[model samples]
Target: MDINNALKADPAPLGLAGFGLTTFLLSFVNAGILSGSAVNVVMPLAFAYGGFAQLLTGAFEMRRGNTFGFTAFTSYGSFWFFYAFLVIFNDLKIISIPGKALGIALILWGLFTLYMWSGTFRLNLALFLTFLFLWLAFIVLGFGSYYSIIELTRLGGIFGFLTAFFAVYTSFGIVNNSLKPGTIPLGPAILK
Candidate 1:
């Protein structure tokens, strides 16, 4: 059996699932649905699914010549790793980060996502909306963290959940479509 043939599987579903699951857990924490020790749960998922899995997916996307997926997945994968590091540091008292600093970091990510979101206008509707929600979520979350505003943070969490939901749908759709071509519609491409 040719080893190359083993790598031909679609990577989008895996990438989307990683992003969706991690985002869902983190959003729940942000939404205050899980308090106290519950926040601890996201650390592992962030590093494993969001970080490593997405990074692998990005590598696969690169192999397929999907620059958009490669860039987005790898970038977000790195983001998750860094985020996990921050949490670990703070949790362990190795380094205490100010809320404003965290806000700044989040805002910077939002800025990057804004540009990515613009690019998504060329993709399908599901992907476009996913990036849209994610971009808004980062902005809202950053501002809320900076100002210690609970309501805005909650709103951001809501947006995060929306982002996750869309990601999940897109992932599953891709999976179904791959299994049986055109079985799931991802909507028309906006740019083509």
Candidate 2:
């Protein structure tokens, strides 16, 4: 193998896994399958695995000149950090954020994800589906929080579960293919 290829590793799997697991845990709470107290369990996972690990993965992607990976991983990683801190500060009574304000933030994230979804057309189906569901989740959750609609929030949680599943599946496929090519399939890119 070339020195460069040997030195660099694929970071997508790590980033995806971190994002997926954390999302799954949080989604359970959002869906009301778990009580609010479950957030205490999710906070540290969000900070460490989803936030920090994905940040590291994004750095690796940057080193590999994968702009999409770098942007996606880093952005989501920062999202995790934001989420953890938001909950922490609220619990500590350090700061209180109105639901409407948080809703606006989520809507902004949805806007970002919608644009990012455009980039996914050149990628595999796994990534495309992941982004699609994520965008839907953000929009539904944003509106739900904004309007204080419980059903919408539950629906958003369902979307989050789908997003997490696809992300985790993509990560598994990539890792499996690395070990034994074609052992798993990530459907072809839509663009080419």
Q: How does each model score on TM-score?
A: 0.95, 0.96
Highest-lDDT candidate:
2
lDDT of 2 at 89: 96
Candidate models: Cα lDDT each = 0.90, 0.94
Clashes of 1: 0
Q: Candidate 2, overall lDDT?
A: 0.94
lDDT (10s digit) by residue, model 1, range 3-116:
588578889899899999999999997777877366578889999999999999999999988999999999999999998998899899999989898888899999999999
What residue pairs clash in candidate 1, if any at all?
none
Off by over 4 Å in 1: none
Candidate 2's error at 97, in angstroms?
A: 1.9
lDDT, candidate 2, 24-123, per-residue tens? 9999998999998999999999999999999999999998989999999999999999999999999999999798999889999999999999999999
- The candidate scoring highest on TM-score is 2
